[model samples]
Target: MLRLIIKKEIQSALRDTRIQFAGTFLILLMLVSVLVGRQGQKQIQKERAEAQATMYDKWVNQGAKHPHSAAHYGQFAFKPKPVLSFLDLGLDNYTGVSVFLEAHKQNEVLYSAAQEGNGMTRFGELTAALVLQVLLPLLIIFLTFNIFSREREEGTLKLIHGQGISMRKLLMGKVWGTYALVLLIFIPVICLAYFLLDQASAGFDPHVGVKFMGLLASYSLYLLIFVLLSVIISAFSKSSSFSLLSLLGLWIAACIILPKATTNLADKVYPTPSQYEFRKTIAEKVENGIDGHNPSDARLADLKKQVLDEYNVSKTEDLPVNWRGIAMQAGEEYTDQVYDHEFSKVENIFKKQNRVSEWAGFINPYLAIRNLSMAFSGTDFHHHVAFVKAAENYRRAFVKKMNKDMEVNDKPGTEDYRVDKEMWESIESFSYEAPDIGKIISVQWRSVTALVFWLVALFTLASIYAPKISRL
Candidate 1:
């Protein structure tokens, strides 16, 4: 009986021109969006590769130079585009891609893609992920919001109901049937996009298949719960127009209004410092120690005393190694400590801000999916932080190597100490690998828990509400 009801629903829905035209138009639009996203991804990957190779070549081939000068010359670290980023851009557009690494200073990632665009770019780019996450739900609403109300108004539901069918069985069939129809268009589009991304990345992400399957599962649950919500609304509506207006209101609240509201509210609750103020705060703390003088000099004086004591010597000339190099390293160590303390406070502020949106997932599944999508794509804050810290560590190691080399080879007070190109070439270039998927999932467990709650609630509501249709 369930199978028969499902078959009847599919046959009737296919007969409607609105359903046919919508499915065809959306499928075509999805294909175009996929092509656009693929081309954009390919171009970025190529550019990053070329720039990284060029920078490494320049650094290795640099002629003989003073060790300190080479530290000042620095190098650029180009972040590679994650293989799965093409599927869902996430925060990639918002965050910077390249970092300038140098001694005595920590640099922020520079050159975000969004900064180059016009005013309209703030609204967002239309990728295939956007089409599925935003537009396809509207398509689902259009097809299902009138499912029961139209039949009730046309007197078909009365005839069917009089044929000894309970509303539960009817609602069950409608939910399953509508889901099947959505899958007809939805499944193919995902498979097509995944295939294109897989080939486009040339197998960079061996876990691409796993990631796509996870996406498939998320969308499947999202569509099922959404259709059930629409059907329950249709069952309660007096007419088709009312059902649509109600569904649209729900969609707007879920997709559009709540996102902006939550973000603004989070900002109000946990504001971030302005750029100038943040930097100024750090600088002030470093400068005004017991006396308003160079904190680096104070730190260097203490470092020289320690080195002299360690070597059991009272005079600089008696020490076998150069105290100047060691003093410079100690200065940077103190500066790094100051930056680390201040930066951690800033990081804590940002974490509090994000917690607002993370918990908002319980109220809005769209927020849940958005966070989860970005995290899995390696474009979220966690991924960005990992890359940045990795670069900083590499910079520290490189600078320390250069300092130690100078201390061993150059005499104290020698201002023109230079190292051969072989020493410079010994420094390894930076490389970054995206964090493991398990780590990303662990960080986003709040969203996963929220999605589970939504699924269970929708199924429970379907069972409870479908039987309440005791009126016309």
Candidate 2:
């Protein structure tokens, strides 16, 4: 009987010209978005690779001075685009891809794609995730809003109910039919994306594969919730139009308005200090105490004296190491400590701000799904933070290595000491490996749980109340 009902619903849906048009339009949009996103990803990858190559060629081929001087010259860290980023675009379009590493200062990643144009981007970009999250739900609502009410309005519901059919079976059949329609519209695009990515890149990693599948599964569950919720609204409402308007309002609240408003509210509530203020405060603290940027700081004078005494040298110049290099390295280490302290403070503030949005998953499934999707795609705040942390780690290692080399090779004084450019070439450049998707999923476990709860809640509601349609 359920199979018969599903077949009836599918045939009825296909026979409707409006439904066919919507399905066609959505499929076409998905295809176009996939193509555009892949092309954009390729272009970005090429540009970043070229930029990193240029930096390396300039640093290695050109003659450099001392190892410490070379540290001051620094290098760039270019974030590579994840293979499946094309499917979601997630935070990629919002976050910066490149960070400049140099001596004694930490630079913020620059060049956000969001800041490139006028305020037009506030409407959001066209991507597979956007379509699946926002538009596809609306399409599902359109198809399911009248599932029971329209039959009642036509007096067919009474006839069917009188025939002794169960309302649960009827509603389940309807939901399944609508879900199939959505899959038909979405699956082709997903398959095509996989094929294109595999052909373009070496091959998709298993981790990426898991993330992609998780994305698809979460999105489908999200769509099911919308279908069931819409059906419930239709079952309870007196008319089709009212059900639609209610569902539309719910959609706007969930997908469009709430996420942005919550993020802004989180920012206001947390009130993180500006970057300038943060840096200034750290710098002032350092100056008043250790003066981490200056090796000859008064606070460090005792330490320097102890070192001199231990070496049995009357002057820093009389020691085995170059005093200037030793002082510069000491200064750098102190400043690094200060920066790390400040960086942690800033990170804590941002995490507090994001926590508000994270908790908003209960109010809005779109928020939950968006967070999960971006997390899996390696384009969330966590992923961005990982890259910054990796860069800092690389900076500290590079600086320490240079300081160790200076201690071993430097002549004490006379400003006559220098390392060959060959030594600089021998030092390894900074490289970043993106974290596995499993790690990302683990970090975003709360959002995943929220999505699952949403699905279970809706399914439970549908199962319980759907039979009440006959009462209506």
Tell me the spans in candidate 1 whose CA falls farther than 4 Å from its real position. 202-206, 288-295, 413-415
> How many clashes (backbone atoms < 3 Å, residues ≥3 apart in a chain or on different chains) does model 2 have?
0
Q: Where's the lowest-lDDT run of ten residues in candidate 1?
A: 288-297
lDDT of each: 0.80, 0.79
Candidate 2: Cα lDDT at 316? 82
TM-score per model over all chains:
0.94, 0.94
Name the regions of candidate 2 deviating beyond 4 angstroms. 117-119, 202-206, 289-296, 470-472
Global CA lDDT computed for model 1: 0.80
Residue-by-residue lDDT tens digits, candidate 2, 227-268? 777777878788888888888898888887998799889988
lDDT of 1 by residue, 1-472 (tens): 7898899878988898988999888888877776777777778978997898888888887778978778878888988887767667888887888998887888888888878767776778777678777888898899888899989988989898989899999998998898888888887788777777657654555555666676667777777877778888888898999999999999999999998999999899988988788788777756654234656557667778888899999987778887767776776676677778878787888778777888998898888888777777777888888888888888888888877877777777666778867887788778777777677778888877878888898888878877887547
Single out the weakest 10-residue window by summed lDDT for candidate 2. 288-297
